[model samples]
Target: MITKIAQIEILPGQEDAFEKAVTEALPLFLAADGCDGVDLQRSVEHPSRYRLMVRWETVKHHTVTFRASDAFTRWRALAGPHFAAPPKVEHVYPVLAH
Candidate 1:
């Protein structure tokens, strides 16, 4: 599997609401084709920053399939308003595991 890591930045005072929106959108990610798991993590030194990690069967599942789905539209609708800037997204494969 591959993982998509999205570095998100929310408006200064919208962190809570942004977190809530992502929480609410969990089901969307879970239900998506090729999606294995999803998680959101807050930065220790950057309160307005977050990382959205989603495991996918392949990169195309996220970049092509999911991006073209209605769920993606809904996700953006739910969380887009709080974005301070466009998210920085990348997909990576596991290089090592204990």
Candidate 2:
């Protein structure tokens, strides 16, 4: 499986707005071909920071399947403006598991 982590920092008072936007935007992933699942988490120490952890069958599933789809465009249109800056995205592969 491939994991994608997006670190989003919301502008000061935009936390509630960002979270609401993300919640509304999440359904777009359901239409993605290889999207296994996605989870959103917030930083306890930093209310304005959030993390999106997504799992896909392969990296190409995200880079190709999802990114190429119209849903992505809509998703971005809905969620893009809430970002403090462009999110920092990272891809990772699991090395160990319990």
Candidate 3:
């Protein structure tokens, strides 16, 4: 599996707006082809920071398939204004497990 993590720092007072936008935009992932699941979380220490953790069957599923889809564009457009800056995204692989 592939994991994609997006860390976003939202503008101070725009937290509520960003949350609302993410809630409304969550459904777009339902149609994604290789998506296993996705979760959005807010940091307890820094409420204005959020994380989007996505699990995909393959890296291509996100880098190519999802990224190239119209849904992605819509998602971006809808959430773009809520961001304090462009999100920093990272792709990772699990190396060890308990």
TM-score of each: 0.98, 0.93, 0.92
Error of 3 at 58 (Å): 1.0
lDDT string for model 2 (1-98, tens) is 98999998888898888778878878888668888888999999988889988898899999998999998898888777888889999999989989
Tens-digit lDDT string for candidate 3 (1-98): 98999999998999888888887777887679888888999999999999998898888999999999998998898788989899999998899978
Of 1 and 2, the candidate ranking higher by lDDT: 1
Error of 2 at 75 (Å): 1.2
Q: Model 2, poorest ten-residue lDDT window? A: 22-31
lDDT of 1 by residue, 1-98 (tens): 99999999999999999989998999999999999999899999999999999999999999999999999999999999999999999999999989
lDDT of each: 0.96, 0.87, 0.89
Comparing 1 with 3 on lDDT, the higher-scoring candidate is 1
Question: Each candidate: how many clashes?
Answer: 0, 0, 0
Arranged by TM-score with the best first, the candidates are 1, 2, 3
The global Cα lDDT (0 to 1) of model 2 is: 0.87
* Candidate 2: segments with Cα more than 4 A from true spot: none
Candidate 3: worst-modelled 10 consecutive residues by lDDT: 22-31
